[model samples]
Every structure is written in C-alpha cells, then in structure tokens.
Target: MTTLRLGFARGGLEIKQFLRSRESVVFTLFFPLLLLVIFGSVFDAEIAPGVSFTQYFAAGIIAAGLLTTGFQSLAIQIPMEREKGILKRLRGTPMPRTAYFIGKVIMVLAIGAAETVVLVATAAAFYDLPVPSTAAKWVTFGWVSLLGISACTLCGIAFSSLARTGRGAPAIVTPVALVLQFISGVFFQYTSIPEWMRTIASLFPLKWITQGMRSVFLPDSFAAQEVGGGWQLGYVAIALGAWVIIGLALCVFTFRWTDRG
Candidate 1:
C-alpha cells in the first residue's frame, strides 16, 4: 500500500516533467492528431453509408496513440534514463522496482486517456464522427484501454533492456514501432491489407487493440468489414490478455537498472 502511494507520487512527478518538455509534448501528444488531420483531409470519403474515412481512421489513431505513449515513449525514455544513471540511482533507493513500474503505468494511462479524448473530439468536431452512445460500448472501451496500455508499457520496459545506449534506443525502437503501425492497419484499412499480413498482425497487440477500438466506435455492421468479417471481440480480448501476460514475464526477466551489455 505504501509502495503504491509512493508510486502515485512518482507518477505525478513524471507527468510534470513530461509536460515541461516541448519536444515530448509535440511528439507524444500531438503527433497522432497531426496524422489524423492529414489523413482525414486527404481521404475525404465514406468508409460506410454514414461513416467517413476519418471516423474509421480516428479509432486506429487512438490505438496508435496508446502505443506511442506506452510502448515507444517508454522504450526510448527508460534506456536514456538508464544510460544517464537515473534508473541506477533509483535502484539504490528504498523504492521497490514494482513501484517504479507502477509509476510508469500511471503516467502512460493518464497520457493515453488524454490522447484518446483529443483524437475523439477532433474526429467529432471536424469529421462528423459519432461518440459511442451505449453503456456496453463504454465498458468495452475501458477494458480494451486498460489491457492494451498495460501490455504495451510492460513490453516497452522489457524492450528497453535491449538498447545498449541512449543513442541506440530510437534506432532499436522506432523502426519496430513504424512497421507495426503500417502492418497493423493504423495507416490503412485492415481488410484492404493482404491476408498474410493480417495473419502476421494477428500475432500482435496493436492489431487487436485497433480492432477493439473500431468495435467501440463503429457501427455493428462495420464488423463485417474486418478480416474475419466480424469484430472478433473474443479474439481481441484473448490476444491482448495474452500479450499482457507475456509482457509481464518479459519485464521480470529483461528489465535492467543500467545500460549494461
């Protein structure tokens, strides 16, 4: 209980420090919004009868934003901190390692919620995207967000152990993130992608996360357009839940307090 309390306090400091950085603010917070605007403008067509391309794209962007906050950000930030001896210093403190990770999870959840709101609002205001109106839909949104954020954040912490230096972190993380986005249908319609690509994407959390977001925001009929011609909510839940478990295991095994080879 005390560790959790201290972790929350640490999270507060993390949020404050994050807000102070202009580059982080723009890249982490606004980059997804920029992608939304550019894609929303360029692809001004209906994905379905009443749904514009922007509406469909919005959910994917929100999923991607969660990835950026939880996965890409932590993957890069932790290694940089480790290289700077910040994590090493923290390791010697009375704080438990779990508390440190709890702090990171809090930061990612807060930022991810804010990012979701901004993306949904922008889509509604400019693209006529409708918010989810049903209680069940909101419930779906909540669980998906929780599981997706946790999976990505823990995986990021685990992946950070692979980076040998601050300078190498982006090189290791960015390409993987970019490839996931492209292949997981963040930047394109999932059904439009090749079947083999979809099969590969099914192995990852982003594909399931994006599909779950679509289930929440899109019409029920839209599920017919998915790879299996259904929303596959059961599969979505299973995939993300599995990743959460896998990520936790990886974090336990691979997390490092220093950038040691």
Candidate 2:
C-alpha cells in the first residue's frame, strides 16, 4: 500500500518533469499528430467504398503513437537517466525497485492515453475519422491499449540496458521502431504489403496492435482487407499477451541500474 502510494507520487513528479521539457512534449505528444496531418492530407483516396484513407491511417497512427510513447520514449529516457546516475541514485534510495517501475508504467500510461486522445480528436476533426461508437468497441480499444502499452514499456526497459551511453540509445532504438512501424502497417495497409513482409510482421506486437486498432475504428467489412481476412481479435490478444509475458521476463533479466551492470 505504501509502495503504491510512493509510486503514484513518483509518477506525478515524472509527469511534471516531462511537461517541463518543450522538446519532449512536442515530439512525444504531438509527433503522431504531425504525421497524421501530413499523411492524412497527402492521401485522399478511399481504401473501401466508404472508408477514406485517412480513416484507415488514423488507426495506424494511434497504434504507432502508443508505440512511440511506451517503447521509444522509455528506451531512450531510461538509458539517458542511467548514464546521468539518476537510476543509480534511485537504486540507492529507500524506494523499492518495483515502485520505481510502477512509476514508469504510470507515466507511460498517462502520456500514451493523452497522445491517443489527441490523435483521435485530430483525426476526427480534420480527417472525418470516426470514433468507436459502441461499448464493445470501446472495451476492445481499452484492452488493446493496455496490453500494447505494457508490452512496449517492458520491452523498452529491457532494451535500454543495451545502450552504454545516452547518445547510443536512439541509435539502437529508433531504427528498430522505424522498421516495425513500416512493416506493421502503420505507414501502409497490411493487406497491400507483400505476403512475406506480412508474415515477418506477424511475429511482432505492433502489427497486432495496429490490427486491433483497425478493428475498433474501421467497419466490419474492412476486416476482409486484413491478412487473415478478419479482425482476428483473439490472435491480437494472444500475440500482445505473449509479448507482455516475454517483455516482463526480459526486463527482469536485462534491466540494470547503471551502465556497469
């Protein structure tokens, strides 16, 4: 109970510090909005009879935004903090390690949710992207967001240990993220991509995350455009659930308080 309280307090501080940085606020919160506006404007064609390209792309952007916040941000932030001895000092404090991680998860959830709201609003306002209209759809959106965020955050924490310095963090993390975004249908349609590329992307969480978002945002008939020719919500849940487990294991084994670990 005390730990949870401390974790919440820590999370408040994290949010404050994050908001204080103009560059981080712009990049982490609004980068997806920028991408959405650019791509949503550039591509005006319809993917289906009633579904505009903007509608389809909006779902992908939301999924990608979650990835950026939960994965890429932490991947870079943790390593930089470690290099600065911030994490090392935290380790020396009375706060339990679990509490520290809880704080990070809270911060990621807050930022990711805010990012999602911003992207969804922008898409709806300018691009005519529809918000989930049913309770069932909202429920699907909730679980997918939770699971995706968990998988990405844990993976980011684990991956951060690989960087020996702050400068090295982005070098290692950004390419992997960019590649996944491209292959996972964030920048293109999944069905339009080659079978081999789709097969490769299936092994990752982002593809499933994007698909889940599509399921919530797109019409039922649009499911036919997916690789499975359906939303495959069961498979999406399984894939993301598996990654949550895998990422948790990796974080336990790989996370280090300092560079010397």
| Number of the predicted model whose lDDT against the real structure is largest | 2
Kindly list the per-residue Cα lDDT of model 1 for residues 206-238, writing each as its tens digit.
999999999998889888888788988899899
Model 2, 24-131: lDDT tens per residue?
A: 999998889999999999997988988988898999999999899999999999999998999999999999888888889999999999999999999988998888
Q: What is the C-alpha lDDT of each candidate?
A: 0.90, 0.92
Candidate 2 segments whose C-alpha is farther than 4 A from its true place: none
Q: Best-fitting candidate, measured by TM-score?
A: 2
Worst 10-residue lDDT window for candidate 2 reads: 252-261
True-structure RMSD for candidate 1: 1.1
Clashes by residue pair, model 2: none
Report residue 102 deviation for candidate 1 (angstroms): 1.0
